[model samples]
Target: MASKVCVFTGSRSDFDRLYWICLEIQKTEGLELQLIAGNMHLSPEYGLTINAIRETGLHVDAEVDMLVSSATSVGTAKTVGLGTLSLAETFNRLQPDIILVLGDRFELLSVASACTCMTIPMAHIGGGQTTEGAMDEQIRHMVTKASHLHFVANEMFGQRLKNMGEEVWRVFITGSPSIDSLMRTPKITTEDLSKELGLDLARPTALVAYHPATLDPLNLEAHTNQFIEALSQFEGQLVLTYPNGDPGSEYIIKSFQKLDAAHGDRSVLIPTLGITRFVSALLHVDFMIGNSSSALIEAPTFNLPAVNVGDRQKGRLASSNVISCAQDSASILRAMQEAMALGKSPCGKPYGDGKASPSIVSALKSTLEKRTRQQLLTKKFSIPGEDK
Candidate 1:
């Protein structure tokens, strides 16, 4: 009998990262794939990305709506609580043999907690990564503890997972599935992008995908204002995407809207670009300006220069193409200028070689086949410097 693999995607970004994995699981003969769409995907404010999932023809087995409209810390906590309750019911119905989750979104953490209580073994991806500027750092580690299987983007992450006492046999370095999307997804031409996005790609352009720094203690509006001021210094067209559904996202959205209004045709603010369009934008844009993880993970594949502003992505592994800058307008402008001047160059990406999906599928198949349910639920912490 086929092993039932249930995958949970809470946001469009998470879905993009998991797209190829879902496809691979669906094609594998001994694996039955079940997808649960929740969080930002169901939120009307987040571009209704569930439609994007539907358009892909991947059948969504369940829909979990647990996003709170409020964009505050309290609201985010409540949303997590609500998601836990809602997912508990969903899991009760599906009763999947194994659950797969990726990234460190709070909603994903909620699902992890529910899965832990239900004694459902979880396969976690993107564990052992560090994003110190937000609360995701702690959440990522917490999810790592709950997960039975760890699939990381790089060897360093795999090592970190081991340091956290995860059994060596269960942790695998599968690279990033996002890199697979970058290498395999059909490229959209510049002309096609011009027609679809109504922006002339012939001239210099920068793709900005800034997200709010959840750890910033002061006024997030001030930080966003500085970012917008810096972008105003750019000489060419700016294609800015909306922030994620974090606490300070609403403020960033308003700032982007204001910038878009003032800049007119020079700037375009899109709520979501999906994976293909985003990868295409990376190909054509002269430089990327933002603190988005994509700037570090996916932009390197295109040999694109990314001016990563602020500390949101401070501790993540980056290639030569990435230039870090402070949140202030002057610092961001200087970094952007440097990135624009540097232009594109040959670069070595630390992420995988565009073959993460198959390896992940193989690992899932073998792990599920060999490990019993009781073994999957039980974990023994491996102390550092001690032989397994």
Candidate 2:
């Protein structure tokens, strides 16, 4: 009998990260793939990205309606509550053997919590990563504790999972599936992407994908002001995409609109760029700007220069292509200069080679075939140097 593998994708952001893994599962001989999408994917305000998922060859088994259209932290919490209620039922109906979850979104918190309560063994990808500037840092670790199988992007992350009391045999360093998705997904030529987004590829270009700092959104407007001040002077053809669904995304979206409203032809705001288009943008753009993790994990694969704004991505591993900056205009301008200077040069990317999908699929199948649910759920915490 095929092992049932259900993948939960809450937004456009994590969906891309999980794409290849889903496809790999669907193709493998003994793995049945199931997909459940919710949150920003179902919201028109977030570009109704569920349609994009439908366009993908893989089928979406279910859609959960859990996103509250509030731009405050309270709404985020309520979304979690709703998600747990809905996902509990969803899990009951599908009853997948293992749930594959990626990243550290608030929606994922609900998914993890519900999975834990239901006694479903979870395979968590992107665990053990830290972005201390946001609450995701804590949530990622929490998901780590809840999950039974850990698929990380690097040995460092696998070790971190081990440090968190995860048994060593349960951790697999499968790297990141970003490169696999980017390489396998049908490419949109630079010209077609340019026409689709109404930006000229002939000129210097930068792709901006900023997200709100969930940890400190009190000064969101101030951050927006700083972003506006920096982009206002940029000479490149800018392709700015919508942010993740979080508190203060309204302010961040407004900042993008403000730039488009003022600059006209110089910049364009794309509410949603699906994974294919986004991967295209990564390839063609000379530089990237924003706090989105793709700037660190995926961009370096193309040797693209990325200006990481503020401390949102403070603690993640990065390559030389990433230039750090404060949200202030002066610092942004300085980092922009450095990013341009660095250009697209070959740099060592820590997120593994372009073959993470097979490794992840193999791990999923091997673990499931060898270990029973009760055995997988059993965990033993061990200190690194306790014996010594």
Q: Whole-model lDDT for model 1 versus the true structure?
A: 0.91
Give the whole-model CA lDDT for all candidates, comma-separated: 0.91, 0.89
The top-ranked prediction according to TM-score is 1
TM-score, candidate 1, is 0.98
Best candidate, lDDT: 1
Candidate 1 stretches greater than 4 Å from native: none
Clash pairs, candidate 1, are none
For 84-154, candidate 2 gives per-residue lDDT tens digits of 99999999999999999988888989999899999999989898788988988988998899999988999
Backbone clashes under 3 angstroms, per model: 0, 0
Model 2 stretches astray by more than 4 angstroms: 385-388
Error of 2 at 188 (Å): 2.3
